[model samples]
Target: MKKYVYPSEISGTIAAPSSKSVMQRAIAASLLAEGESRITNPSFCDDSLAAMRVAEGLGAAVEKKSDSVIIRGGINPVTDTLNCGESGLCIRMFTPIAALTGKRMVLTGEGSLTSRPVSGIEGALGQLGVSVKSNNTLLPIEVSSILKGGTAAIDGSMSSQFLTGLLMALPLAEKDSVIKVDNLKSREYIDITIDVLKKFGIRVDNHGYNEFKIPGRQKYTSTDIAVEGDWSGAAFLLCAGAIAGSVSVTGLNSESCQPDRAVITALRKCGAGVTVEKNVIHVKSGSLRGFEFDATECPDLFPPLAALAFYCKGETVIWGAGRLKHKESDRGAAIISEFKKIGGTVKIDKDCMIIRGSSLTGGLTDSHGDHRMAMACAIAAMGSSDAVEIDHAECINKSYNEFYDDMIKLGAEIK
Candidate 1:
């Protein structure tokens, strides 16, 4: 779908969307738990839904409600083939879980997820006595045998997601497991995973992000969990407020382990009016100035940070461009190419993304089938001199399905 966003001032408050990262992890944990688990404030986004489907495919009885999901856990494997539906996390995280069934299972995904690398999955699972075969290190991976668990080594530089799977699945192994990680990135995401594991009565010992120790013969105890608001999606709204007008976003935890909470720090650094009162975060337009942010641990912040930087006075430099390569799209390249269409100056140098602050003379942009790219372009368009038309605007449904509606409610002129 294509949508045009015109320059307009926005005001009023909106509730942040539920965190799919948390919701998906909770779903995986619930699938491993023996009893019924109730998850409140869940996100029904595409990725989360993919995780739910995978949970159900692996023999969990899932019941969806208006605002919650009830899951009764088991790993009986109702089908040999599980479709992950364009969710990278689902394919990577659930591969290990599927091996717990001790049955031959095929894990496949659609769209961009099909092309994403499954580098560490095969090697790590091999060490744990699970046979894994992939499409030349990509998706549509086949797994057989059980996760007996022992010592495994994986490189964590590309992503910490597969490691999260190990941490979650190893506890149920017949023997204790130890994972040695090298060059680990996105450590905060592991924190979120461990936090979710704790809720399900699972335990893991982390040794300086380099290794994890898990005791075997542990059982997951199901419990009710409440999903927190996503800082990843809320960053775009806050950036919109910083560029156009005032916006107060509620439902975000003041202290979240999610790395995107650094958005607040970035806003303050860029001279935006930011006030935090418990769960409510208010950001207002101010004399915006360039800021420097190292997104090494929070690479998802790149898009919104890029948008926010466009309206600043000088130049903003965001580090960690190297991490954007294997995302939904080549995020760094997409951001630069799309923003160039809208009169924004952005360039990537080595591991840094440099954006020169300027007023947006909007034109047509494209989401490149990336959710964050779509939201960033829309937010950046709000302060443009002309309307910015974005192709593939519907892509935001992956993470924030109501993003356009929320912007419209906040007075954005979108058509």
Candidate 2:
């Protein structure tokens, strides 16, 4: 799918997309509960659907309705193979959940997920007495033995997802489990995990993001959950408003543990007019200026921040390039390479990305099969002098299926 985005001033009210991150965890937790669980305003994005399919493959009866999903939870598996689509979260988070079954199971996925590392899944699960194997460090991870909870030390420098998997899985183990994490990144995501766990009647003692204690034999209780609006997806819409015109995005939680919610602070610091009240965030074009932001915890913000920097006056320096190497694409390189086609000056200095504000002359770029890269290019187009043609723009369906439509609704001339 190719997208042609013309420079246009956009103004309107748009509802933010539901958070697939939260939805996936809710589906996982719901699958563990022993009764019917209802998820309201559920996300049907590709990743969230993958998680729902994972839950079904694990023996949960899943039914999708107009506004909610009904899931009946159980641990019995009807399928020996669980396909996670292209979601990194599903593969990592579900690997441990799948191990709870004593029967052997094979977990696989498509696209970039097949190339992403799974050694951490193997090591972490192995230490907990689950027999695991992976295709080198990639997918096709196989677990043959039931997960036996015990003390384990995890290397958290790469990603906090492995720890999240352990945190979610250890509660159902046969014995109490202790997880000691070193150099944890994205601690906020762990907070989101804990929040979801609590809603499902599980308790995890988080000790300063370094240690976690989870009692085994813990059971999950099914209940109704309302999925929050996604800050990560909303960042693009908000950036579009900051660069082009006034736009009000509704449904985002001001208190969301999502780290990408920091984009609001970045907008305010860069001189964009911001009005925050309840779940609606109104952003208007203003005198934008360069600012420094550390995205070490919210690495997904890098792409939108790069787009936002194009309208700023000076130079914008964003830290945390190291966090992008393992994403759908080498996201750090993808952002720098694709944004340059639109006349944005972006360069990487060690682990920091430096963007110098300049007039944008939009041209052609590719999504590189990354949803955020596609949305970022579209946001940059709002301030461009020429149309921005994005190849593989449909990649946005991974998280925000209606991203272009929402932009069009906001008066962006995108086709």
Candidate 3:
């Protein structure tokens, strides 16, 4: 699908979407809790749906409602194969959970996920006594043998997702486990995982982000919980408000542990009007100027940050380009290439992405099947000189299915 976004002044209020990160983790935890878990304000994005299907495949009964999900948790392997769709988190996090059943199963995914390397998963699970086989270190991973808890080590530079899987699955093992991690990134994501585990009555000891101790034979006690609003998704809306006009976003926890909350700092640094009160964040247009931000721990911010930078006065430097290679697309390259198509300047130098603020000429760009890329381009178009045409705009459904509608509600002229 293609979307045409014209320059417009947006003004209004909208509730932020539910966080898929939290929703998926909640689904995984519910599947292990052995009783009914009520998750309120759930996300129904494609990624969250994939996690729900995986939970059902593992023998959980999931009931979906308009605003919440009720899951009766238990793992019995109703299917021999689980399809995770295109969510990287679902495949990485559920592999260990699947191994807990000690039943031979294949964990696979579609689209970009199939090409992502799973060797880290194989190596990590092997150390715990689970037999893992993958397609040349890629997806379609086959796993057997129970996770017999023991000491294991993992290289965490690439992603913190596998560690999340280990942490979620380890407490159920017959023996206690120890995990020594090297070069862990996205530590905040680990914090989110631990927080969700606690809600499920699971415990894990963290040692300076390098090691984790898990006591075995722990049972997950189901409980009612509400999924937090996604800072990652809200960042784009906040950026939209920063560059165009006033926007007020509610449903966000001011104290969210999600790293993308750093968007608030970046916006303030760039001279955007920002006001925070309770769960509400209001951003309005200001004398925007380029600013520097370190995105090493919040790589997902790069796209929206780039959009915000496009309308600023000087130059914007965002650190952490190295983490963009393995996302839905080579996200850095996608941003640079697509932004250039719209008459914006962007370049990557080693580990940094630099953008020079200028008037966007407003032309055609492709989403490259990445949801963030699609949203970023759309947001950048909101202040452009002409209508910006985006290809594959449907990609937004991956994370924020209602993004375009929300923008429309905020007075953006889209066709």
Q: Candidate 1 vs candidate 2: which has greater lDDT? A: 1
* Residue 85 in model 3: lDDT: 97
* TM-score of predicted structure 3: 0.99
lDDT of 2 at 6: 95
Single out the weakest 10-residue window by summed lDDT for candidate 1.
84-93
CA shift of 370, model 1, Å: 0.1
For residues 198-222, write the lDDT of model 2, one tens digit per residue.
9999999999988999999999999
- lDDT by residue (tens digit), candidate 3, 1-415: 9999999899999999999999999999999998899999999999999999999999999999998999999999899999999999999999999999999999999988988899999988998999999999998999999999999999999899999999999999999999999999999999999999998889999999999999999999999999999999999999999989999999999898899999999999999999999999999999999999999999999999999999999999999999999999999999999999989999999999999998998999999999999999999999999999999999999999999999999999999
Q: What are the runs in model 1 whose C-alpha is more than 4 Å off?
A: none
**Model 2 score (lDDT):** 0.93
Residue ranges of candidate 2 with Cα displaced over 4 Å? none
Model 3 ranges off by over 4 Å? none
RMSD of 1: 0.7
Q: lDDT by residue for model 1 over 1-415, one digit each (tens)?
A: 9999999999999999999999999999999998899999999999999999999999999999998999999888889999998888888899999999899999999989988989789999999999999999987899999999999999999999999899999999999999999999989999999999998989999999999999999999999999999999999999999999999999999899999999999999999999999999999999999999999999999999999999999999999999999999999999999999989899999999999998789999999899999999999999999999999999999999999999999999999
